[model samples]
Each structure stands twice: as structure tokens, then as C-alpha cells.
Target: MAVVGLPPMGCLPIVITLNSPHGLKQRGCLDSYSSVARNYNKILQNELQFMHNSLAMFGARISYVDIYEPLMEMIQGPKKFGFDKIFNGCCGTGYLETSFLCNPLSYTCPDATKYMFWDSIHPTEKTYYYLFKNTLPILDFLLKD
Candidate 1:
């Protein structure tokens, strides 16, 4: 079994828009939120390690997939992975609109491959592909027994 860590929620367009300072137009990620996510990951990792050790007598192989770093890398350097828009989604204005707000009538970008997110809370297929590709090694190791 492999458990994946949380992505950088602070960097999500909706989160950034809602948390940014009143006068700041850049709308980048909130460091406080990022720190919370990091802390949660640490706790989860420690718990998983304890479980792995406890189940060692039963021949259990539990692995932890650190998705935070790679996802952050993609968010920080989207161009390196062929993504042009890391801060917004493909639907509508790509800011706070998502789900019902990003309806069938809403305008979607011509090319979703250029965007990292499909909506305010979800990632695009291209982003998922990158995440899946990065996790292949861990999956292989887990399956090797």
C-alpha cells in the first residue's frame, strides 16, 4: 500500500485569491497555509512509519509517496513540464469559479494542456499525468514485494 501526501493547497487559485493581502495583486500562496500542510504531511509520515513497523511481522510493505515536493516543483516551474498556466484553471476566468460556477455555458480555454488546474479545486489531466508518471517508481517498488 502506498499513501500519497497532500499537494500545496495554499497555491491553489481559490485559496490564493481568498487569502492574499488586501492590496496585493499578485495573489501568491499563503506561507501559513503551506506550513500547515507541511506539518500534516510530517504527522502522516510518522504515523505511516509506525504502522509499517508494527506490521512488519505480518510481511506488510507500506510505502509513503511524497507528492508535495514534485507538485511544488511543477507549480513553481510549470514551463519545464510544458505547462503555461500554473496559477489558474482552464474554466472561465480561472480564479474563484469552479463546479457550478464553471458550467457548460462558461468559457473554457482552447488548450487545457497549458493549464495545471481544471477548476479551482481540481487538477487538469496533464497535471494528473505528471503526478502519475512521477509515482510510477514508487508503485513499482511497492509491487515488487
Candidate 2:
């Protein structure tokens, strides 16, 4: 089994819109929120490590997948991963719109593959593909006999 870590929530479109002083005009992630996510990841990593060690006697194979760094790398360098938009979603304005707000009537970008997020709170398929690709090594290790 592999435990996947949380992505940078501060970089989420909704979070940035709600937390940033400049709102949509803001660039990059909110440091405070990112700090909170980092702290949580640290605790989670430690707990997972402890669980893996303690369960080793029973032959439990547990692995922790660090999704933060790779996701951040993609956000920071979208072009490297064939992505064009990192800060906004492909649905509506890519800022505050989500779920019901980003419905059939909403304005969606022509190419969702170019954006990292599908809506304000969710990632696009392209982003998810990258995340899955990065976790392959961890999954392989955990599944190894």
C-alpha cells in the first residue's frame, strides 16, 4: 500500500482567490497555507514511517508517496510537462467557480489538457496523469515481493 501526500493546497485556485490580497492578480502560492500543508505532510510522513516500521514484523509493506514536490515542480514549470496554465482551472474563469458554478452553462476552456486544474478545487486529467506517473516508482516498490 502507498499513502499519497496532499498537493499544495495554497496553490489551488479557490484558495488563492480566497486567501490572496490581490485575489486573481496574485502570482504563486500563499506562503501561510503552503506552510500549513508542509507541516501536515511532515507529520503524515512520520506517522507513515512509524506504521511501516511497526507493521514490518507482520510483513506489511507500506510506502509513502510524496506528491508535493512533483506537483509543485509542474506548477512552477508547466511548459516542461506540456501544460500551459498552472494557476487557474479550465472551467469558467478558473478562479472562484466550481462544482455547480462550473456547470454546462459555464465557460470552459477549449483545451483542458493545457490547464493544471479542471475546476477551482480539482485537478485536470493532465495534472492527475503527471501525479500518477510520478507515483509509479513508489507503487512499484510497495508491490515488490
Candidate 3:
């Protein structure tokens, strides 16, 4: 018989590194009650600071990609498409319409093709396209060099 050993936990450190704060938030995550949630942003920020410092220690070039500005611009300011889309999603009912409630049983919006959010948590295909078009510059900046 052959004996098996567990794989080394290489992901634990990377998990800590990635979870450190970038100040970004997902919908409904703001209302979470976990203690980790309270300090999540700070932890993430600190983690990024640590990474930046570590990179500097090794004399590696680092750059920041700020996609938030363009994403916000698309959401608030005028754009070439879906000028009237503001609230409500193309899937589910009320606020929790995401996959949780919007799947299999709940009522979905009549016309998904014309809505911004597909569910509460995800953007509709059309919305994604619009956002993608506007975010090209940021994407280019990140992919450059």
C-alpha cells in the first residue's frame, strides 16, 4: 500500500497578501458583521503597503492601475449607451435578487436586455459591454510594458 501526504500550504501567505486592503467593496459586503470585515479595508491597505515596500526593498518597479475613476465615470456621467439606466436590475426581486433569490423561483425583470444589473450582485451583459468599452484606457495602461 502507498501512503499519501498532504500538500504544503503555499496558498496561506498569498491569501493574506491578496486579502489586504485595496479599498474596493462588493455590494452587500458593507453590511457584513464579521470582525474581519470591519478591519478588512485597513488590513488590505496595510498589506498593499507591505507589498509595495517589499518590492522597493528588492528594487523592482511597481505601478498602480486606477480603474475606479473610469468605472465611476461610466456609472455617473453621460456615456454613449444606456443613458437612462440608474436603479434596479434585470433579474430577481427587491434587493437580494442576485443568484441567491433570483434563481429558479423568484421573478426576474421582464426585459433583461435593457437593464444594468442582471441580478443584484452582477452587471447585465449590456452593462458589462458599456463598462468594458469605457475601461479600455485603464486596461491598456495596466497591460502596457
Candidate 4:
């Protein structure tokens, strides 16, 4: 089994929208929220390591995949990932619209690949592709003996 860590919450469109007036004024993040994710990831990684060792006697394979740094890399370097919008979603205003709010009436961006997020809470397919790429090595290792 694979356990993935949390993404950078400070970069979430909804978080940014509610926390800042400028909203996407810069490709930056709130250290407070992001730090929480970091701390949580550290704890999760440690716990997973404990589980991995503890379960090894039973021949259980539990791996930890880190999406935090990879996502952060995408956020900090959007242009490198072919992403033009790092802080907003592809739907509606790209600020707060998510799930039910993103109805047919809410138009979507022409190119979702250009946006990191598809909605306020979910990442776009392109973002997932990059994240997958970043974690593939660990996944491959898990597949090995």
C-alpha cells in the first residue's frame, strides 16, 4: 500500500481568496498554512516509516509517496511545468468555485493543462500528470522486491 502526503494548502485558490484581498497578486503562498502541511508531512512520513518496519515481519509493503515537494515545485515554477495559472483553478473565476458551484453555467478555461488546479480543491489532470511523474520512482521501487 502507498501513503501519500498532503499538498500545499496555502496555495489553494479558496484559501488564497479568503485570506488575501489581492488574490493571485503573486505566485506566492502563506507560510503559515503551508508550514502546517510540511509539519504534517514530516509526522506522516515518520509514522509510515514506523509502520513499514513494524509490518515488515508480516511481509507487508507500505510505501510513502511525497506529493508536497513536487506540487510545491510546480507552484514555484509554473512556467517550467507549462502551467500559466499556478494559484487559480480552471473553472469559473478560478478563485472559489468548486464541486457543485462549478455547474454548466460556470465556464471553464479553454486549456485545463495551463492551470494547476481544476477547481478550488482539486488539481487539474496536467497537475496530476506531473505529480505522478515525480512519484513514479518511489512507486517503481515499491513494485520491486
Model 4 error, position 142 (Å): 2.1
User: Order of all candidates by lDDT, from best down to worst?
Assistant: 4, 2, 1, 3
Please report, as a residue range, the 10-residue window in candidate 3 with the lowest summed lDDT: 1-10
Better of 1 and 4 by TM-score: 4
Better of 2 and 3 by TM-score: 2
Locate the minimum summed-lDDT window of 10 residues in model 4. Answer: 20-29
| Pairs of residues at least 3 apart in sequence or in different chains that clash in candidate 4 | none
lDDT (Cα, tens digit) per residue for candidate 4, span 26-52: 545777888999999999999999999
Each candidate's root-mean-square deviation in Å? 1.7, 1.3, 13.2, 1.5
lDDT by residue for model 3 (1-89), tens: 11111111111112222342431222211222223333453455455556667876765433333323333444555344553443345
Query: For model 4, what is the C-alpha lDDT against the true structure?
Result: 0.88
Q: Candidates 1 and 3: which is better by lDDT?
A: 1
Quick one: RMSD of model 4?
A: 1.5
Ranking by TM-score: 2, 4, 1, 3
Off by over 4 Å in 4: 24-27
Clashes of each: 0, 0, 3, 0
How much is 51 displaced in model 1, in angstroms? 0.4
Q: Please report how far candidate 4 places residue 32 from its true position, in Å.
A: 0.4
How many pairs of residues in model 4 come into backbone collision? 0
lDDT of 1 by residue, 52-112 (tens): 9999899888888887888799988889999998877899878888889988899999999
- The lDDT for every candidate, in the order shown, is 0.85, 0.88, 0.44, 0.88
Residue 129 Cα positional deviation in candidate 4, in Å, after optimal superposition = 0.4
